[model samples]
Target: MIYLQLFLSYLQIGAFSFGGGYAAMPLIQAQVVEKYHWLSMTEFSDLVTIAEMTPGPIAINSATFVGTQVAGLSGALIATLGCILPSCIIVTLLAKIYIQYRNVKIMQDILGTLRPVVVSMIAVAGLGILSSVFFLSGKFAPALSNFNIRGIIFFAGALLCLRKTKLSPILIMVGCGILELLYQTIF
Candidate 1:
């Protein structure tokens, strides 16, 4: 029963996590903390930290971690499968039909149109947490006091690494983490 619940919960999370990562975080927090009482806000914060430090999508990481905590190995497997199922189905269908029509002008036009919209969504997700992380005075936009230099370094370095070099993301992350330690300790 617990494993079933975990499966369903993660299935919902996977199905609706449109923009990915931070976008899905608040929904997971509400589901786990408010609706189910599975974890406290602090625990969710810890989970967010751990997920951000890892390699995969935040929603999948959260599902796996929370599921395992709730019901051990079976929970982990079920939740992971549930989280992946929606994407699997969607991709399978799209591949089957989209491949045949992918070069069509209408389909090409639609996908081209979606590119900028997706970029805008990502920007919105990035800015959403700024208020929560930096500003405590109730202002909801970026200010000088709460600007995250570490985050800027991480983003810029990661972008350059991926675009200009052949370094893997894990190696880049590790290097950035070390730089962060040095920046804190020395500067």
Candidate 2:
């Protein structure tokens, strides 16, 4: 029964999540954290972080992690399948329609409109992550006293690297990970 619920929940996420992994963050957060209470917001944020660092789509990674945490190996498999099932079906269907109407203005228009929405979704996901990491309350509304200085420093450094240097994102992440490890050890 829990497996079925997980499947259905991810199926809905996969179906509605149009612009890929980052776009699905809010939906995943809503379902897993807010709706189901399977994970706290902090846990969900940590899951997202782990998912991002792993070698697969964020949605699938998140499903696997959350499912495993909740119901073990079988749950991981079921949740992953559920998360990807809708994407597989939708892509197949879209491919057929897209091939036939590759030149259609309406289709192009739809895609154009989705670009901004996708950007917005990604932005929301970014803010969610920031809130989780920087706010001691692990929520959007952070009191001044609750601000995480280390997190802020990390964020600023990452942004600086992104803006001023052409360093690979992987390198930046690895660097940050090492720095964080050192910080944890020393302080």
Q: Residue-pair clashes per candidate, as listed? A: 0, 0
Which stretches of candidate 2 lie above 4 Å from their native place? 140-142
Mind giving the per-residue lDDT tens digits that candidate 2 earns over 1-187?
Answer: 9999899989998899878899999999999998889999888878987998889999999999988988999999999999999889999999999999989999999999999999999899888888878877876554688887788899999989988999998889899999999999999
Among all windows of ten consecutive residues in candidate 1, which has the lowest summed lDDT? 130-139
Model 1 C-alpha lDDT per residue in residues 1-187, reported as the tens digit of each score: 8888888888887877666776677668767877888887557656776888877888888888888888888888898888889878877888998989988899989878866765675565455444333444423445676555556556777789999999987788688778879989998
In Å, residue 102's CA in model 2 sits off its true spot by 1.6
> Candidate 1 clashing pairs?
none
- Which TM-score value belongs to model 1? 0.61
Error of 1 at 88 (Å): 1.4
Q: Please list the Cα RMSD from the true structure of every candidate, rounded to 1 decimal place.
A: 5.1, 1.4
Candidate with best lDDT = 2
